[model samples]
Target: MPTHYVYLGLGSNVEREIHIDMALSMLEEHIDPLRRSPIYESASIDPRQSPFYNLVVGGSTDLSLAELNAWIKDIELLHGRTSSTQRFIPLDIDILLFDDLAGLHEGIELPRAEILDRAFVLYPLQQLAPHLKHPGLGISFAELWRQLQPGPQLSSVRYPFGVSSFALTVQAGRFPLPGDPCQLAAI
Candidate 1:
């Protein structure tokens, strides 16, 4: 099958660690044609849940946008996620970008602003595809890193779980999400 580039955002709070594990395993088993983004850990925004473990994954696949999204929704359900309960959950997966405005649904959006706002998503994305320009923002990952106020402190924090040794070369400023049209202009 021909492949199209796609970006996915991942998060877990309810049973943070275990949910992430299940999500990853499900991805590998069902979301084939995948390459994972760097994993990031961050505090949960919802008061009802624990801290979240977040990350983005990049890859190309032949599945139609809706088809792929449906599969993901199924995975979320298996992990105990529900559309009605949004405060916090064991797992939350979103389709960040799908091949150049190709996959957006009637209500669905792309290059989620949340990706840029959260350090977890940006840092890991820098590791996985730093050179890839944001669909909306013209700035590269290296450029965004340079623009960040203090820059990501990759050296200071250590993750309890295993991490890939993918190092990003950041240049130090905050960056916009790839799919955001405003951010795409940076490219």
Candidate 2:
């Protein structure tokens, strides 16, 4: 069984595709059986700023929540993530969920706030985990997305790299059933 089942939100507007790809590679080093949502493009906080490429990844981690946060912060710094006043954020990774534990742990909140408020996070997350209830809200992600007021339009991006290889059924709480093969990415 997986030790720490989690979901993460990733975004970038600085060399968006390359940064996202690089971040995904680093994340795979610590999170196994990673599954990702299709890329989504949404306008940045300011319409004049470069649009952002965003997606969500789900997987299991062997590290505790605090250890994972430290690793994630390291990834951002290594990627040259910088102030976005000029829209030059190389990469940004946020911990959206860590198992089902709610409230705060190690000064980090579970089921990140963005999951409920940001379309970039919510859309991709629902694709990867539509039925999994929010650890705090107790409502399915699918339902939360439905309740959301219209926000920035999120269009799919045809990112030709990175693979989303985990099974959606895993989010539904069933994995590796008899004769069920692991999900494979196309391209």
lDDT of 2 at 163: 30
Q: Each candidate's lDDT (Cα)?
A: 0.65, 0.83
The weakest ten consecutive residues by lDDT in model 2 span 162-171
Score every model by TM-score: 0.71, 0.82
lDDT of 2 by residue, 56-131 (tens): 9999899899889989989998988655354577888889999998888999888798788899999889889899
Over 4 Å off, model 2: 82-86, 161-187
* Candidate 1 residue lDDT tens string, 1-187: 7666788888876767688777777777545566775555566655565667677777777777777788889999998888746776778888877776722464577666655655666777777778877677867765676566643333222233443222111111434355533221110
